[model samples]
Target: MLNLLQIEFHKMRYNRATKIFLIIYFCLFFSITLFSSIRFNLGEINFQLAEQGIFNFPYIWHFNTYFAAILKIFLALVVISMISTEYSNQTLKQNLIDGLSKKEFILSKFYMIIALSLASTILIFLVSLGLGLIFSDFNEINIIFSEMGYLGTYFLKLVAFFSFCLFLGVWIKRSAFVIGALFVWWVAEGIIKGILTFRKQKYGIKDQISQFFPLEAMNNLIKEPLTKLGIVKSSIGVVNDVNIYWYQILIALIWTFIFVWGAYFLIKKRDL
Candidate 1:
């Protein structure tokens, strides 16, 4: 496994584009700290994000993970380009010629996917922990640790999404087409969901069936946390919401397996 990872590491090491994208991804990841300093003053309407208690314990776990998940697109560029560049540069063919098995190649890419997802999860966990400790009113250990399952959800979110991107990168072998494929797939899922939701009203179809879609499943893993803000809560009172759903995680796992296996199946069947 180390050898496989090292092989991939060296492939990316000298690529200037890979280096730039990775550095930018982490830089953007760390920039979430700046939200704590956000302030707005418009005439009598003075607002501060810090005072909103977004950084509060337990809640911070949810808030930070939700926010961090938005930044996946930046890292996604790395994953897509990683494979696309291999085909564009003839490296994929060269690697096979040099006696690296098809399975080993896929394993290298999958391992890197796991590593990147784990690293992002760890960074977000630390950032959330630090901000919560400094700002949360509830200091008890139980309160501090509660809702940490968001870290797991966040990790699963990235791995599943990145695996899909990796599969598209291999299947299409072009960066632009892969991105376009993602957009088209997202739109298709939305349309199908809308239709299914409509059918639920008339034909007694289950709305939960929409949750089986790849992107929707991944989205269902983590919900928006904006409604949890202090001001919103004060004004609207408590809203009934579940931050994480087990079914969403299971759906995402199924999709991740399908995508990774699909990518391998494609490579194995291709004449290259």
Candidate 2:
């Protein structure tokens, strides 16, 4: 596994565009802390986000992970670029000629995906821990470590999403079109859910069915964290409360397997 990742990173190391995108991705990720300085002044209602206690111990874990997942699109671009270039530069053919088996090639890509996800997960843990220590009201060790499960969900979300991007990149072979394909899949899921709910008197079936979709499975890992804030209800807007369930992690894991396997199957069969 270590050797596979080293080979993939070696390729990325010399790719100027990949390096630039990675730098930009991390910069945007760290910039998320800038939310602490956000202010909202609506006539007689003045509010500052930093005072909202979102940076509180357990809450900071969920908040940071949610936004880190959002910044994942930048990494998705990197994933697509790597796969697209492998084909465009004829590296895939060259590697195969140089004695790399098809299974190892796919394994190498999957290893790279896991490495990126693990690194991002560690970054979130450190950043959230730092912010919580500085700003949280409770210093109890239990409270500090309470919501660490969010980190797992965040890691799973990245792996699944990037795997989907990898499948698209290998199948489509263009970064722009891969993104377009992602958007189309997202829209299709929404449309399918809409049809399932068209003038229906119930939402249970719709919700249950939508949960099976790839993107929906990933989204279920982390529901919106913003609505959990007090100011959102008192000032921002009325919002519904969301529950965090452990089963969503399993759903995401299954989708990740499907995506990675699908990509591997494609490369195995294609006459590279």
Measured against the true structure, the TM-scores of the candidates, in listed sequence, are 0.92, 0.91
Clashing pairs in 1: none
What does candidate 1's lDDT look like per residue over 161-250, in tens digits?
999999999999999999999999999999999998899989997787888888888887888787777677778797747556677788
Q: What's the number of clashes in each of the models?
A: 0, 0
As a whole number from 0 to 100, the lDDT of residue 103 in candidate 2 is 85
Question: What's model 2's overall lDDT?
Answer: 0.86
The best candidate in terms of lDDT = 1
Off by over 4 Å in 2: 38-47, 198-206, 233-241
Could you give candidate 2's per-residue lDDT for residues 53-164 as a string of tens digits? Answer: 8888888888888878999998888899999999989999999999988888888988898899999999889988887887788889999999788998888899999999
